[model samples]
Target: MLHATGSLLTIDVGDRSVTTTDIDDELAAFIGGRGVATKLAHDRIPFDADPLGADNRLYFASGPLQQSNMSFTGRMSLTGLSPLTDGLLSSNAGGYLSRNFVATGHSVVEIVGESDELLAIHVTDEGVEFEPVPELEDAGVPAVTDAMNDRHGLESEHLVTIGPAGERVVRFASVMTYDERAFGRGGLGAVMGAKSVKCISFDGDSAPALELPNEDLHMEVHREAATSDDIMRRQGTTNLTEFLNDEFSLPTRYYSELEFEGAADIGGNAVEEKKYEKAACSVCAFACKLPTRDEETGLETEGPEFETVFSFGSNCGVDDVVDVMKSNELCDRYGMDTISCGVTVAAYLAANDEFGNAELVHDLVEQIAFREGDGDLLAEGVARIHDELGVENWAIKGLEHAAHDGRVVQGQGLSYAVANRGGDHMYSTTMIPEYHGKIDPEGTAGKAEHVIRNENLNALRDSGIICQFGVGRAVEDDRFERLFDADFQDLLSVGSRVVELERHFNNQRGFDGEDDWVPYDLPDLESSLQEYYDERGWNDDGTVPADRVDAIAGSD
Candidate 1:
């Protein structure tokens, strides 16, 4: 029903051969991005397969909205079986990579097998080319992207690279774009490293013609976003630090406290002082990505986003904005998830409360990236660290928590507990309503219904692969019909079905009620969990009924 000219590109690294197949049925059933990619993971990866082994496949997928003129449609979804969680993982990043990917005339790119040597894959209009990149060994993400662009001529090409963390197979490695955007969770970069892939560069001039249902409405949304007084427009996501800190929802000292003492030093105002420039993804009207530079050190990098500020700053007991920027740059360059890296460091620093030691945080991030000294243990992520050190580490299903403190935000807590990807904030962000004052942040009553509805809505957004912030505001304004030509209710139904599919996949792989526990001991947690399960028609034991699953699947 959408476009069918694009094929699913499959590459076997072992033989260095490429194949293409039409995925019309898959496109119709699962849509694209997370849905289609998760379906591919379910079909191709064995439950018992080692995540880093040849049996596992990595899928980079773009949705139908990709390459459209619509705002916030530039995001891409990367799905794989996570080595950390040992479950289905999908991470999204905003950049030109998805646009370039769509331009290559492919809906999905699947890489299988493993390369015997360090290599890079270049995809162009003609075909795929695998080139050995031995020189890129032990390089950081920024360096690798620079090298790839230099080699290929950077005009229209975009690079997705892994750094030292991935090269060493750190369990929380991240896959990064050229400008430091990352598919930054669940150890996906390790999957690329396990396959011996240094980078994947995309270059093409073929863009599928996009015909929006209402071009005028699309323009209207863009006009509104461009001139809107949204905090995102003024200060980017970094604004969340101050707001969350004000609400006492910021995780500080490894969740030992709900608020940070030095919140003012690393918040929106502080970040604005060091802002070097503002950046945005392809066709995005809300240019929320800010690249900052420290005047003293002259170290410039893409972000120290709200998560970075909370994780590296407050969570690690550091308050210096420059220090957070340095840590963010190091994580970006080294190819590691900032949330996991920062939280892991916080666990090691739990004994000390002095906080805000820039030098100490920098050295610690370096050690983790290179696996030097205690970095080896931290590199294993929060779950394994908790097991080995007997520390009270905060994580759900092996993935580390985001910036939100579950002890305070009951709705976020419930969503975090049941999220398929484990401790993911974006999976079903109840924060939107909380932030907008539509819902009481401290209340637990009726939160389960709110979370369930938001979860279903978010599933549709992610499957459409739209930027969460942009589409989130659109959904709030009831503009889905204007932008996507789909009824909001229909989209929510699709989202509910996607949520069921994800839960089913996790269940088949042995996750149950026990795995749905939040890391924190909140008073209202038990009641909230019960409410969530009851609202979603799931059994009290956290199992979805087979008949319900069948009905949802049948509707699809």
Candidate 2:
């Protein structure tokens, strides 16, 4: 088994108290990261608890592989009840935070109860310290991160901070680390804001010894990733733009169309022209993160990733590459999810016929961060915009849809409809097969099975908290089995159980077959959902049988 400190750090902001607990058998059975975090949320958070209330708990969890020699294991999972979705929410990000957080001898950090005053929580090997950071009030993410690092010294600390958008409790606010990386969905940042937390900094130096079955195999994986022909390494995630546009799956003009006339202007090749440096998470060999700088505007930022490009560039009709990059930088600095920010802005632009107005987009981003004027409504996310204005807003389970235009790709549409985390594409990348032509995009035949299998595999990958880019190669090379020293079938079984647990969480909150729907009309949706339920052994009503839940939990 992997070695860890196996400790849980609990911070009660309301009482200004801290406590620690040993990881117990029940939590251990679920492994770590997303798995253990979900169990904690299920046990501690009431199904009906206000997502932004003191009663709602926020968890930052590191996976078992974190802090190990494994490549792409530097990612972390953040979980809580989402103000946006009103159900379970788990967002993952990659950076130095996970490695240092795990090194602090705590696998999980759970925060509860709101503070009366704004505070910053600092974690070290000595213990947790809560300090008031009133000066950070209404600060942007980059400024907050910089101020904290300057105060604590950058070499020794990693910081996660919320920007003014989060300070205002905007529903889709993001928590950012390393200036650019984010726990970028589901309004978890609003949860932190509700607790009056400005930032979290970790400066622990303790490193747990990892027991690897084959160190040589671990090295081999890293070596392969460094020399691999993976597209991620070559052009980052923006490489998807050309392919998505070619397949007519790119979201353009707020999902009004699938293809953009200016798609090539903001695609991978365009991003390369502005690329200044390539960055990576701790020990990750892919180095997929491209930090770019605009020569004309002197704007510097890390990404306008595939999703960001779709959200701001095509979706909002702002096709200028530099403008999209600037918008992405604004979202990062302001601590707002680019997907939500871009989509919300797209909704406004579409209603107003202000497409391609870069100046208006910039002004709106600032307004939303500060909750100024109409930006207040926009900051609430696309669902609220749809409710208030009766615009053509598309979302699944309250959260805004990702970059992919589901209308063009039926399997992707189905994935969005049934995804536990609303319209998130990362839940299960069903579009992979369709993109490669292994499956027909329009055909619904066997799509449910494809999604189910992908979800289970994705659950496994998320539990390890591995970067999705490394997943295919990892599985093909049997890296997971060798790293965990467990059978592949057993690992897959655990992953299936995790997926069921997530479904069970949603089911308890009264989600049913009706709730699983694409915002746009799909003729074959009913049949597809029925097939999905049948394939997963769920009831036709989309509820897992009680026995099935028990069986999955019992398997743990």
TM-score of each predicted structure versus truth: 0.95, 0.96
Best by TM-score: 2
What are the RMSDs of all candidates, in order? 2.2, 1.8
Model 1 residue 86 CA deviation (Å) reads 1.4
Model 2 C-alpha lDDT versus the unseen true structure: 0.82
lDDT (10s digit) by residue, model 1, range 1-556:
2322367899999899999988767766666788777777776788777889987888898887775666777788899989888888889998878788888888888999989999999988789998998988999877776776677775323888899999888999999885488899999999999999989887788865555566676677677767778888757888888778886578888887888889999988898888877778888787888888887889998778889999999988888898899999999989999999998888878745435666888898999999999899889988887867666858899899988766677678778888888888998898677767788777566788888888887777777767888765754535665555666676676677777766776777788888988876656777778888887788898877888867754533
| Model 1 global lDDT (CA atoms, 0 to 1) | 0.81
Q: Could you tell me the lDDT of residue 72 within candidate 2? A: 77
Once fitted onto the true fold, the runs of candidate 1 whose alpha carbons sit more than 4 angstroms away are: 1-5, 155-157, 351-354, 475-477, 545-556
Looking at model 2, the pairs that clash are none
Lowest summed lDDT across 10 adjacent residues in model 2 is found at 1-10
